[model samples]
Target chain A: MKPSSLLAPVLALAPASAMAGSISIDLPRLPVAEYHRPYVAIWIEGAGIQPRTVAVWYDADHRGDPGTKWLSDLRGWWRVAGRNIGTPPSGISGATRAPGHHTIPLPADLKPGAYTLKVEAARETGGRELVSVPFTLPRTGGKGAGNGAGGEIGAVAVTLP
Target chain B: MANFIMFKSLALLVGASALALPMTASAHRQWLLPVATTYSGEDPWASVDAAVSNDLFFPDHFPIQLAQIKVTAPDGTAGAIEHGITARHRSTFDVHLTQPGTWKIGTEGFNVMGSFKVDGVEKRVGRRPGPPPGAMGPGGAPAGTPGGAPGRAPVESVALDAIPANAADLKLTEAISRNEIFVTRGAPTTALFKPSGKGLEFDPLTHPDDLVANEPGKFRFLIDGQPAKGLKLTVIPGGKRYRDAEGGYDVTTDANGVATVKWTGAGMYWMTISATDNKPTTPRATERRMTYTATVEVMAP
Candidate 1:
């Protein structure tokens, strides 16, 4: 028997953390009249696999989670992926941020596959914007990245390494 | 923005004098006129006449900015439209229809504001209409005030001056208007009707480009992808400089969020609907409102 075949089963038994990597997203500022930090939802969606939410930037710090009610307003994300994420998210959620670049590391449980990184943002009294970056996760360990733009979001660059 | 206010105010003043209406009442109409609805060839060049008229159908005879217009292809791609030639009564854009499906041509987010500052407090001026039912009620106001009609979604712009701007409060009045058109060549496509996620949207059960004059059609109203009921709709015939008091048709959606309307004329048609949430959880304005407008060219039998 080939030794590589024997090692294939051993590799399958290893934890997914052995393939973990990090992604950084650069977000530029928008010049609008009434500017506010956007409620951003970043996640990975792929064919035949459950969506993995990397981070959700919203007004979670608000009292009683009043902002959560508007979560459904995100439409595409909420209907396709967000609702699946349970309430009181332990670590995947955070507060909104001012205009600038930010980074989010992938979870250890992420498996190697073809996935799309999606970022959707909605601001108060402002338009809603969505951008998607397609990427491939290598088996061992590597990197992939892409970029786009929107009215409410600018200079959207995603890097997985 | 400044030009929009002037044109709108001019129309309002003219309508107010003719109808003997209150200063708070605004009567501006937006219309789209196509050189022809149906073409015989594969590639057709069309000139569309666009304007913000007075009352129901009369031409406003004012200048309209071309930057306010947008066009959507049959494949659902939306983009800004320029290269318009402005005349005395209307502005026109030349559209080359190369696709074999429906195209949506329209304009939105046109707003006019009248503001006054007092005591460092910037107060809104004009009429503050109540919110639509099932959404937010009138912000900080009683349920049924004399400010506006029920079933009418409050304009995105509010007139805090309805309470009268005194020494303590600044007064302002804002009016917003939106317009659109649905035109098709061969098969009908739903790409142009995608929900913007910022306002009320029309989910057409019957193809807008397929509607024939005097034929019945069905439509559904949606907000955030959910069926919304009790929404009011207005439909008006195109290519007119004036209209009677009962010129347009008005109807409200049923429990299933369906509104049925039959055509009466063989011309371009304008349909509009609006929804508003007056009480927002955010710290900004007390109301959030959205208005949707669409134009469809109905074929003549």
Candidate 2:
């Protein structure tokens, strides 16, 4: 089945209020010798303040060694907040996703200020990439998008209402 | 002959060859390069290599003495060095990072080296067979002799009061050297970054383990617990064997004793700084030489 079809149901289940402020992430499929789902982290950060994690997707369950063992591979996120948040962070962690568009709801309690949304992805035996989009709180008129350098990630779009 | 003697004493004081001095470009640089500066998982082990070589990160000249190395955990407690081995060119060791946060691995050395004259005969202060046990004057017990490495020739100098009362031309030089690197098992911490307020030290505005390429990293230098002004800092990236040119830069401290560098690329970097001053905490010493060296890995942005 097409990966985009898998997102229809997830989008339908999202609360109407969450649709007001949400981020859409696209994981690009690449032609390579070996394939593995990329572990990803999404977070919001502002000037002079600690970053807030939005979502983290990885192989939460493995037989012997858990996927958290390689979270540091996502250097950009690990250095900022992942290391402190601990494994399977309540309410923010999920299983790894297949190649396609994935939408995540933003926190409603975010204060009114200028902030940046960062999406970082890392894969085994593959390259890492980060995509960033700057947005202001309290609902801006249009949508913002950032394109990754094109390795493990594709395009990330943010919609603020 | 006097120049050669001075060179040997400087080598003994710093635990490397005379070429290891920071001032000379042709000099051999000393460093402790880790396999990786950051790690994750339930149990992670960090392996490090210690050497003095002409090229950065390539162990070729001589292995740093394992005895001089020390490890400090994030809680300011002593860490252990395991499975240590010294090869022809480099010394290797393993550190099992059982605790979370940052760990420090390196060495600190202090020695007094100079010459004095008794009965018109010039006698060196630091060398094999120091003054007799009786020569240790009241309250002069050869304090701070750099780790007392076993089986190695003792380089401890005689105490100030141990010098003959009739001794003339009493000249002494105090030397302090520090070399270190930081590794983080999970999250980076500053518990191991506290300055000892003695000799040359680091007051990092940016955590050493959190450095990133293309971003400015600010670090302050301190001498005797105070800001060090006009100090020269040299940073050289590793992998010199692959590049035709030496990719490194030099920066000087401002009045605030802070040196800022925006790394050009991502890799391990060797940093070094040296200073000379007449201020000596030990009595009768005419001058002091201080040197600090560190190896840090910069992540790609």
Candidate 2 residues lying further than 4 Å off, grouped into runs, are A1-20, A47-49, A143-149, B1-22, B118-120, B127-166
| Pairs with steric clashes in candidate 1 | B124-B172, B125-B159, B125-B161, B125-B172, B125-B173, B126-B159, B126-B161, B180-B295, B182-B295
B1-301, model 2: which lDDT tens digit per residue? 5433332333353363331244665677778999989987677889999987789988876678788899999898999999999776788999999899999999887767677777877666753332322343343333224323334344334655678788799888777788999999887889776888887889898989899997988999998788998998999999989989887789999998999987988989999888888987888898888888899999998
TM-score of chain A of 1: 0.75
Give lDDT for model 1: 0.58
lDDT (Cα, tens digit) per residue for candidate 2, span A22-68 = 78887877667798899999999998679988999988775666778
- When summed lDDT is taken over every stretch of 10 residues in candidate 1 chain B, the lowest stretch is B16-25
DockQ agreement of candidate 1 with the native complex = 0.01
lDDT tens digits, residue span A26-103, model 1? 444655667778888888898888777878887765675446645644545664566555342858888888877676
Q: What is the interface RMSD of each candidate, in Å?
A: 21.8, 1.4
Superposition error at B120 for model 2 (Å):
4.1
lDDT of 1 by residue, B32-79 (tens): 766655432335555677765654344565534566667777876664
